[model samples]
Target: MHHGAYPRSISNLPLLRSTVAPKRPIAHSPKSPPSTCRHYRQIPEEEYRRRLAEARPLLSNRRAKTLETIGTTKQHRTFILLCVAAAVVFYFANSQKVPVTGRRRFNFLSEDWLTIFGVSGDAYEQELRREGVRFAPKYDWRYARVMGVMQRLVPVSGQADKDWKVHVILDDGAANAFVTPDGHVFVFSGIINLCGNIDSLATVLGHEIAHNVATHSAERLSAAIIANLTSGSLFLLLGLLPGLTLAGLWTLTGGRYVQSLIYDLPMNRKQETEADYIGLMMMAEACYDPRHSIGFWERMKVVQSQSRGYEVPEMLSTHPSDGSRIEKLTQWLPEAMEKWQASDCHGGQGAIARQFRDALSHRRFMGVAWYIAVPGDWRLSIP
Candidate 1:
């Protein structure tokens, strides 16, 4: 991944992941009293540009050797060949294999490799989630309902249930949500503030899920390797085929490189749109109120506009602006809403809230009051 500035022209963007996941930098600050430090002189824009030009040569010269290592722009053509020759030799050299959706993933990543790339990460993350605050009661119900929807959808996606687990993280201040390649989900509490109801949340989840479903994580990692080994003239690496390295694959999903990829790398916009469409369809199938997606987005637009002079919106942090998203979502609303209503059969937007309210009425009375309210005699008896 290129350690560089965010590109104004995305083609030059780095294939790195985001450092801003679930966290954002404060956008507005009081103009610091003119910097009193000796090195704080403000240069004119023209002078700044001139200084940048002046520095470019020296910077380029310093970076000459490292640039040579990046190889060539079309990483796949040559690097893949080089890596493939190495991979084939490495493949038969060992009987290792990797698994996914219960099928063999990489012929080279066998039982030993799986054990090497084992549950350490998952166990640590589990501890982190447990140490985190528990979400409010209603949040649990929403999570269960959403997970149920994904449970139904993943099979439709042809993903194996035993192999892929669904997860939720309940951070109230977090406006973002993401799913790891292994199906661990992190949903921030701040997200609830941005979205109106289940459908909207579903839209967000669906987008992240789409990234995993499309194997975008894996592909992006390959792209990174290609981009990194940019100038290799090894034609044998071409058509070397998709081989997953246990270590490299995990790094792509879990490490800083992915942070660079999500935020800094030039994303395939078509994939983004495709995820929206597929996620929309999945939400509708789950009997959610798809129209809430519109309301939820409108709220985001409002929040973003208000934040303009104060803070940057989360949508812009990883996604396109609200105006374009709203328009695109609206374009597909008719078809999605039609399917949603049929699956719903009860009504629209209000129906989800009503269902949630009813669940609360039942659970509080049953799970709470029954367990806690009338236990005096029983408690005394037990004692």
Candidate 2:
């Protein structure tokens, strides 16, 4: 007699209950990194937004959960499943073994493409020079010094001189330095100034040079291309899912999407480690103090700390911090020291002559020039 169906509205309301699936629980999506990296944008925000939008249509049907809304997005379970699938396919499709590390990797790359790209890269640099880029003798000194270092340390890459013509330019305001294939190295005057010494300069040069020897640059380019192609394919396939979020797509791809777009995962501390070992060897071979590496890395760490982690696009781009890099370098020190010593370090012998003798023993070169060269003899003459 009292209840009479409870006025229907009260029965249907049920406090804090579902009105169309309980507000969809706001859903529990994962916190995704930015849609792209900071390096990809010269102007940043506006340009980034523009590019993301252009790529958005690719993810058009994907759910759009921002970082704030991430907590409620329970949709990660589905994403995890898709991620597993993507991971399996990606691992198999891109896996490769590095010649140096002999470590198999999930990177899409090959030396053939590297050489091809090198041709174009060389062309591009020549164009820049043609467009009025001048080579300075001091920077040329930097180039020769760096090249000389590689020749002494990295026997495999030491002969880069034979095929790869070295180039250097002085960009006084440039805050960065980079190396291109075909032995072209660009150094900024600002970098030289900040170096404070040859050791600092050697550290920077060694890392860039290592990228070439390890084929890391080629690996980077391959990953970048694969990332784009895979992301584009994912964008299309995502429309088929229609319920997933953009953040969901990013994490599922294992940061490849951002890596492809903005380049976050391009060079982590791991690759930096590889460079450190290779670099130290090169420096030692050049008869420069391997101790310089420690100081150079320290300076970078100091600069990073002073900046309070607030720097430019590099912070948000491919690089890890100096602190992390220095720590990793520490781990490699004992091993690197052993290599330096095994090469007859401590000025006990001429590093170049020792290197040539070792090369001759390997039967790789008949007459090692640094040890066997005569001032008048252009070629090796047997007694």
**Candidate topping lDDT:** 2
lDDT values, one for every candidate: 0.46, 0.49
Determine which window of 10 residues in candidate 1 has minimal summed lDDT: 374-383
Q: Give the C-alpha miss distance for residue 230 in model 1, angstroms.
A: 2.3
Q: How many residue pairs clash in each candidate?
A: 28, 9
Summarize candidate 1's per-residue lDDT along 1-383 as a digit string, tens digits. Answer: 12211111111111222232345457768677976667667899999998888774654755765454343346644555566556444434432122121212212211222223333325635555455544334347656655655554543342332144444445543455555555555455566556656667777766665554544444334344433443232422322222223334546677555655464333544435556666676577666667777787677666546544444343334445566667888999898888776774322333222222222222111122311111111000000
Encode model 2's per-residue lDDT on 27-70: one tens digit a residue: 78979967774555367798878888777453334344353333
